[model samples]
Target: MSTLAPPLRTSWHLKLAVLSASLLFLIILATAFAQPAMRQNVQPYLLDLARTNPDNTVSVIVQKNSKDDASLEKEVNRLGGVVTKDLHIINAFAAELPAGQAVNLSTYPGIKWVSYDAPVQKSLLGGLICTDCVSTTLLSNDYDYSINANKVWNNANNSGAWLQGQNVGVAVVDSGVTNNLDLYSKNALLRSRLVAQVKVNTRASNAYDNFGHGTLVSGIIAGNGTLSLGGYIGVAPQANIIGVKVADDQGLASESDVVSGLQWVNDNRDKYNIKVVNLSMNSTQAQSYLVDPLDAACEILWFNKVTVVVSAGNNGADGKPAVFAPANDPFVITVGATNTYDTATPTDDTIAPFSAFGKDETGGVKPDIVAPGINLISTKPGLAVKLALDHPDHLLEANINYMRVAGTSFAAPQVTAAAALLLQSEPNLTPDQVKYRLKATALAKKAKGSWDTRASLKAYDPATMGAGYLDIYAAVTQKKITDSANQGVPVSKLLWSGDSPVNWSSVNWSSVNWSSVNWSSVNWSSVNWSSVNWSSVNWSGDYWGD
Candidate 1:
């Protein structure tokens, strides 16, 4: 009995020692893994800027590990930073701090990351040629038929309902959308279609479009052709507009204003049923989409189910890579411009000379789709009428409140309006699904005579045209089932990765064979541009150009 007791006691002692060792091993492993989390929370640019100007106060985004406001405020105070605003929606705070102090805040226990609030400028180019056509007549333009928008409106489904983009809301985040006579009328349906207009900038008391850009974009999306008497209708005439005025009177907007506008849209998505957002402007500063704050803000909105459409910029003539921020981001639909040549048939369509194109910084193919933007006549601001009339050579047609304009800015809204029609047909479709559907159903560019021969000595490339022109009827009526779960980078992975100050160098490059985008089947030499009328061609306009 004594021997048995000794053995039992020894066995219990050995079990206790093994349990303690196992617990100690787990503690060591956890500590080793967690040590990397304390290294640095500030982006490299912020650090460099701080070193150069330690005392300069700059706006920053502060992400905290704790949710308690008091704790966050205390931390900010301790770090010599002033809390400018609390963005609780993103679990972060907007603070203004001395550059050096802001960088130091990254060392705090509860801090996650500190990012400089980058500035975002509007990208617009002004160039136009007046069409000699009479104002009293209704001309059939090529863009509507080029994209097949007219067919979508005329076709009847099993339910006898035409895809007119009813009940869908598209948020235009840009210069204020004015109450143009073409946009708003005595018709209750038209009046209510403007839905909600919010001024995000404190500098403006009213939400009127002082800069003519936003009104034109809105008119292109949902203007009900009241002024033209159904001759110049927009792509989705019945879709509602949720105008988010981020840009000021000078057509300038900062990153914060855009972010605030996006946040408001996210919060009020249900109130307005905003399923699509048209970002017709581009940032001058180019950055990797993985680390760009504007791209991050756009991704958040996209993940929440808002279809974001951005202009690919009008920087094509500069010889620099034209794709720039938020458009450079893969998640959003980056649109380029195609000249429909003011005709209904797409046989003469060509890639716009001024429209930007290229692979994004992350190597993603951009300008996911192209649309008719050259000499588009849409609703213009009250002030632009005199400007258009003064420059008769640039005016295509000037009605009481409408003017003709051209830019990649105008091209983006065409896709946005089409997205509204798609959502109206399938409200449950995810943002990824919408993107895939548009790309899959697009009309392949004709290899011959598809581009202006005078501007280029070589053949047209797919890099400029993406998946070709926007095909609204094909995108809406086709019954193809797609699972976009694996396409591009998932927004969820970007949002929840917890890898703040994203190391862009480490991003896994897409293995997609970009060479596969080449169009070798068509004869390029047979194309002749001499048949196209050069006099009526509007070369006077450029998109987002200097």
Candidate 2:
């Protein structure tokens, strides 16, 4: 009995030792996996910056698990960093620390990511152009007719009532907007539409636009055409404007400032009934939307029902990665520029020369729509006019009241204005619904055949033109759109038939009976492409750009 007892005791101790060893092995394995996650949380550019300038101070976006501002500040202090800004909305902090030290913060407990403080700039390509300086014709501008806004106003539902974006609110987050005569005239209707103005930059004493970009963008969105005497009414002439001044007088904004402005918009959305926000600038750095702080901030606004529109950028001519941050994100409506050929006809409209295009890192096609940005005439801030007058070559054709400008920056506001119009019609529509309707109802550019010179030149592609040009009337009037509130349609389904080489008629437009249809007899133009699910379509090796 004594011998048996001893053996039992030995076996129990052996089991205990084995269990301890196994637990230790698991701990080591967990640490091995955790190290990579920590490394990945740090953006690649930040790591590169650390390696190149270890001792130099760098600005970083430090994300944390806790929302407590005090704790976040303490964490930054522990890492030998100074907190520059507290972005409570995103549970993040902007800090300045030695580049080498910033990398070490990634290993700290509760730290989610440490990204470089990326810079953003206003995206303007060309100075404004004057089409006819001598003429005083009161005709609708080419941009208004190009997007069919005039038709939407004159349609039966509106019956020439000027659907003037009543009660809709649009927030322009850019360089501050000045008190332009077009927006702030004593006319009670136009004056009352400037709902709220907030200056976000520390350097700016007031909300006046010194840089000229924001005023131009705002004019494109909600300008009442007061200066032009109703000859240049914007897409949503009656929409309320919320001026969010994120950039300074120089038209430069940091990632932190932009994020802060977005946060402010989210907070004050209900106050102003701000249903739309226009981001007419682009971040210079091209990071994955999955990890970009700006992209995350933009998504927050989108999920909260604020329809955010961003510029795809003017970097296409550079042949670099064209789609910029925030714009690269799939959720926000990224708009590209299209040239209207100084005429209102749809056939002559071509993709703008400098409009950026490319798939995001997730392979999501971008620049969801294109609008008239070439030589567009809109309200000009007083300072902008002064600068243009100083350099006439920079002016397209400037008058005392308006400036002609071109860029995806201007293009974005057109879409923003369109969004205001849609929201004015259906205020209950979710952000996804608004996006779906716009893309679904967009007009397909007139095909120029296979051997057309434009096709040979590779001027436009799905990535560039998106769901084609903005058709405001069709977007507002479409009755049978698939409500995308639950699930988003893929970009492949919206690709223009002419852009793809595949025979689409053989594919399903609505049903799965691919084998039952007469492929040759199908009318490609008549088929409702919006209702078709092209999930099985392969767009691999498709030409995006240079």
Candidate 3:
């Protein structure tokens, strides 16, 4: 101790002060790092765009806090935004905004996030409010009776009330919607229930179905009995149809064009009362839902309270097909196809061999439900629309205006129509709520039969049948369901940057690791698929076209 006396006697107070200073430095450093993490609102793509060619303009979808649409548009204008499409449903805007401005937009007041217009990247840390929250069914023949749409319209409880989806609009975002007699408005106040029509991806003059797919999709959702005299009444016949043409005369469209079409739909949804969007198309790309632009688009739509319905693709029972884009997205309802075998019961029904199944790249199961796809007939243009021209034999001898088509494309609109009916029945239901109700009420196909026979149940495989087959009657009339469909679920955009899929258990759902992301990995290039880029390689080119 005597020898150590020379070694400057360090006091306990000095040690305490050193420790305190170290902690204070750490706290300040952490605060500096934490601030940006708190607002990881700029999409990686927008960041890249800002870094490279900052002056270049690209269409981006922006999510902001500002409630005023006019003011928001003005802000966008101030930032050199052009062709700005108000996607108010998601509290966003689709504009050709300058790259630098789009990236820096996150710092602006009310600006939450900004991403390339493929779909989007929305902040995970906010409460949702449906921007324009406004919110049934019957059918005939194989799907009509099979899906129980007929019973829904003429049900004993709903009897004369006729829940035919009054005022609800189903936007058919496809080739275009040809005006058929069945699609005409029966009301005196309105000229047509085909509420809005606009050309999306094409230079076509009008948004009428020269390609035929949109009309068929629309008819499946809301065709009346003008031609068949109630014999071929559609599901939710009284529902409004908002036709958006994203394809050319040859039934081809670019993904950008399709996105623009959706932009149009979102902009005008309030005007047309469009709540349900029927995307009867599939993406050819196998990109993870985490990065797929289409997935981004559908996600924003779902958040904005629009019920998005997509086809599961026609890749067939392959080696676990990566369920195509919007369909692979967990938020929207993805539909698969089932062959009714010309019967009205599920005992004889089998999953269509050509219908795509999935365990998406993100490990999410796909095709939320199945519906009649094989030999399903709906409104087709009498003139040589692409589908009709491609398969002349499918034209019904009884009615040339109706054509039988098969694929998940036809199956998606059925669910869209059901959603319309559900909205009509319960106007205040959110998209997540709608998803929950549809899934909760959907009857699980029994091991030996449908829900009609309360027998031994089958182990559900979400890849094949999703929750179960579409049962519109049960979905509409079921007890009130309040749970959110996405509760404790993984969102597509929050994926980890590495090759490995995100471990949802360990992730902080409220924050994003923006630094690790490389948005250049996202493929926005458009290549000719011999048809529309929205159609899958095997889907529209071969199987779906059949």
Candidate 4:
């Protein structure tokens, strides 16, 4: 309901070093704090935030070690910091303090970690991240055969009406959603399937698809295509939606905006029967899920029984080492883009050239699943919307308006629809079960396909593709089983949740291994922490914060 403000104590000192002037970065590396028993609790990025802000006002989410959130609030209040939110779900609270005092706050005896509220935006190509730069690679508009959405849609109940994801709600945390005909409710009393519309970004005029990307993402998940006359239906036509706007009209957003949006989802999940959350965007940086504040926010929702789906970034062809957060976080189902080539068969599907590939911060092959992202068509608000205006070539309108856009940003919604469909059928599958089923039943990308042609026992690459392409039919029909995907994974909160010995401070902090997130992969020389310059990265509603 309010901005993040918390108490701060400027008692501790943590030095910020620019390891490589050639590369923009601010990392503690824990070399200075590696004394007798001091644990590096404050994230280095927060220090950078304090140093670069013109106003010197920094916001953060502080995680506590043992005591309740109230005690932590009192401590923050004593330090003259503003206590913004009491994040009970993750044993943490959001607060705003003086920029340079984050390390002092981290020194609190009970505090576990302090994370910077960084900026998050759309998951477009790394350098080419602009509304106008993203090319409209429209191949064809066929969802039924491409991802087998038709099979799931065809299965009807005894009542004669098929289970087109009826009533199961998905929270679209993006720019905004338009109340177009495709999203209108089947019931006469309801205005649209969007059961709720909340705006985290108060700067925005209203919660509508002025940016246009949110409308497209919303349509991909549950658009009925009432305007297209069955020509372009979404994965779950009958599924309801909840629009949570985190970005402004121009599609720019901060990580705090997203965290607030996720908080809204957590608070209202049961009220709207919200089962899935579609995050087709990511943060502007790539930090380990263990310390990344955004990961904690998304994990809170996943723990509260909301299945979170995220898109891998568009850094595939660029040779980047990892995907951005919360996609880099393993708890949620992270999806990548695949060029379906307008074909039903899986033999020809290849990970989109621009679709993000390679390992995440944890060194695990990212994109738990893949879906058609290139040249995909979905509902558009209008030609005046930001995305449509930025790339008019993407607007392929008939009697009803639709836009063709490409990137992992668009790919993730297909899986969100699949998650909704599965939840609609069973209504009891946990987030872990949903993730396990999707990865287990996915169509493994084969080498017999026309491209790589390399012979091997396993057709898919364990380093990049993870499981494989999306098969909604197989995923939804899988045996309803319960299992945990993050059994040995780091909890992300406790001091040194994942101790790599090789990474971090070299002063082993925790017992958990954090799976195998090779922190060494992060290039210290290339990270840019200076005031996140967005003059070039015009993320058109793909707010995937790192």
Candidate 5:
């Protein structure tokens, strides 16, 4: 309810990079310190209230008082502006401000803390080493990269044949970065299409990335080879990466900034033929409004035939039900976390202790699926830069450089990279089709009926793991039209929570030859492939006799 003072005269595009995962981004405080009421002589941080068409205003959420919200709203109204969005607790976009301004934002009333919006840069150096035979060790060191290589070598149409001339494009909408030789050597990282870049301050420019999160995320998705754990590599080693630096070095981003990034991708999705978008950031608050800017952007991407993957969040059991904004949005593919190599135990695919869960205020399951996010390793920015400088291929093993970190953020790019490979295999699949194939064909990491207890092998629960673990080979091979669920095969009863409905409005029995079947007791007449309600329907029965 904070009132905003208007008429700063600078109306730059406000891009708010909202969070979907925890490990992939740097966050910043949204609101900066404004004129402090009842306190004179104390300089307050200034909040940038970017006016979007007067009716919609994106405010940089800073530390402020609840009582002051109303006053702030009044102040904004005075300037012909409205307080459209104020995410008080989760400020991932605040990283764009200068250090002094960022400090002022942290001290405002009721402000717990402000995180800077950091960008995710690509690991160019890693790419250079891996593609060359001399840099084979670059793919050996990291476990996550090993897993990715395994998935790709086994499923990507037999040893990288499908990747020929594809040059799959991925958008890393986090931090800005410069082109380097490591990525250039293997032709893995593409810097040519810098569709757009925005910075809060003109001094640093969009290329500035202090937090180094964006570079890391991009490297995970497409780092060809600069260095290896011993010899590790990214998932889509040959894919082209587009760095969208929405967050500043501090890792903070405003809501508008996030929306602006999405809009940019949506407009340019066709130009680059960008297949997938990986968001590793998260928002603390679950947006209640249907027309939320983040959600709207997701829907736009979905309609434009672009796959959007988001992190479930890192707010598990901290306070409220583990839910994050944009991640919770229905249109976006929400990913949760699981441990790598724990399939034998019930803990396998169980939501990571730090990973967020999905349930609305009314209690509904969230996070459509979970991937390996815990203790996962991937590329780093500084290391990539180092690799480029040394040109590891030309240097000795001692000259190689790379980095590793773990989080749900690290896990998200795996799926994003997988989607890119899937797109390569099935170039005609729509975004929704890709999502369904991902869920439908995912191999169960654990057995059935396994709960909280960490057994050797257990079943994946919809409440926690959702449709099970990611299986690239099966997903690429699985036929959507022949899927048992789509074929009207029998699926067992399942217990689901949330707003899922049981009734169908349209059904296609062509796959089953059920045109002559009775319509009285069966729900065969109203199954809509486009809007299949997963929560309300169970596919377990389809496999029993199929």
Candidate 6:
């Protein structure tokens, strides 16, 4: 037996080589098989968009054909995504899918979530730069407050023709307004004005100004008084103010409270006929509707015809972009801050040092546009208190006069005022159309490094300030019409099977008559509530909360 074995001796090197080759082949096969499945259900296409627009997000819209949408959801989760909303086959899921996924469409299936994002700007102003910059008019006893009595009447008050039937209203949803002499002194609320000071907290009951932020914001939008030192008049001083306080005396408010306040606005928009709503708040992250109260409220407002404005957070300069919420929404009008006085050809409207930059996890351009947010002057509620302490000479008893401050918060109201004026000039415009008009009418500033004094007058680019500086005059006078017809899947008409009532909120239903396809009225009683498209429903009249 030993001799026979010796005669047929085999080489160990050949056997070892074969074994290694087989192992390598197995690895190759495993890798090839796993890659496709990993990408099969993930939304690979949205990664690029997310990367390009840091401040913006992509909404993955997926169509579910199977039972419970569970299979589709499971696939999305495996690919490391959270489901933001659930839509019946008729309604579409609009999810703020996070960044960092592969960009190839071949990686995922049933992934339809892909939407461009918009920012949310706020109202009011603040910063240390305002300390020495208080208006000097009050310091001099010679200050004649009566000198500019008629100055408050600008484009917003153009009598007759262009301003006749085109009346508009703005809901200053913030800290309650004070009856300041500066505003009331000049009759800022033109007879048609309606004010509702809703409490930020039910316990507090009164939305009184503990911190003067809201008051200042309101002044910037419609204050009629002269600046104590040096400041400009608000963009629109004629629009009505509806105060829904979300911040408290401590200068803070909760997302839930803000949502409730917005709900109040939605319930009463008809009474005020509020056309523009300003929200100058921020949240670091955009939670899914399952967990976020503010996002849900905003969805309601955005679906309605209200033009909502929000801030693009102040978290910045740490290499990573600051987190700006609500403004991250696709439907809302997001505004960023820019330094004032840098009006060169290559507009030096670079991201403010404190202003947050946009980037997907992988880095992207964020912030739709920039406004003059730095060192602005607006109204302050505690102005009476501060004025009594800082400048007793300027105080007028019982007259909630005006003061100044600075921040993106204040900058937002300037835009809001501008928007209010535009709305007043053109009442037929829908929220979306108004947004398009604003973007289209904005004047292009010089690029960061471009040589042209006016690089271009075209619509915005994602890389630079999205649509450039907002020009209210241009938005109001532009001959082109902005179309606001929502192309999204309409959920308002869909019927839903849920514990919550499927009908539109009584407030939404009562405010306006929806466009009907047939001669029959589409009131709640006439329509087959059961057959209605719940997917298109907008419970909030026209403003996103928080």
lDDT of all the models against the reference? 0.66, 0.65, 0.66, 0.66, 0.48, 0.47
Tens digits of per-residue lDDT for model 1, 1-546:
000001112466598766665465345333422454434456555767876776688888776655664576666665556898876644577888777666566656676557677543222223222121111112233476668776675344212236767788899887777765556532453456788889897776677777666777898898767665444678887778888888676666666677678878878888999999988877665556655556666876775688899888888865555677778888899998887654454545788888888896556677898898886777766745333445445433224456667788899999999999998988888888899888877777342222212222122357887777788887877646454522546332234344232333355434332222111211222322232222111211235321
RMSD of each: 28.2, 26.2, 28.4, 27.0, 23.5, 25.1
**TM-score ranking from best candidate downward:** 3, 4, 1, 2, 5, 6
Output the better candidate (1/4) by TM-score: 4
Q: Please provide, for model 5 over 240-351, each residue's C-alpha lDDT reduced to its tens digit, 9 standing for 90 to 100.
A: 6767766655455655566567767766777777889887776554454243445545645654567888777666645345565566665566777765432112233355
Clashes of each: 8, 7, 4, 25, 110, 63
TM-score of each: 0.62, 0.60, 0.64, 0.63, 0.55, 0.54
Residues 298-357, candidate 4: write the lDDT tens digits.
Answer: 776776688999888777776665677778887888888776554334555676777676
**Candidate 1 regions off by >4 Å?**
1-139, 157-161, 184-190, 384-398, 445-460, 485-546
CA lDDT, candidate 1, residue 452: 17
* Candidate 4 deviation (Cα RMSD): 27.0
lDDT of 2 by residue, 474-540 (tens): 7777745646632432222212222222344455433323222121222234333222222111111
Model 5 ranges off by over 4 Å: 1-138, 141-149, 154-160, 163-165, 178-182, 185-204, 317-320, 341-350, 360-364, 383-400, 445-459, 480-546
TM-score comparison, 2 vs 6, better candidate: 2
Candidate 6 regions off by >4 Å? Answer: 1-167, 185-194, 226-231, 286-291, 342-350, 359-366, 383-402, 445-461, 485-546
TM-score of 3: 0.64
lDDT of 6 by residue, 50-88 (tens): 446422334555533232445556544533455777655
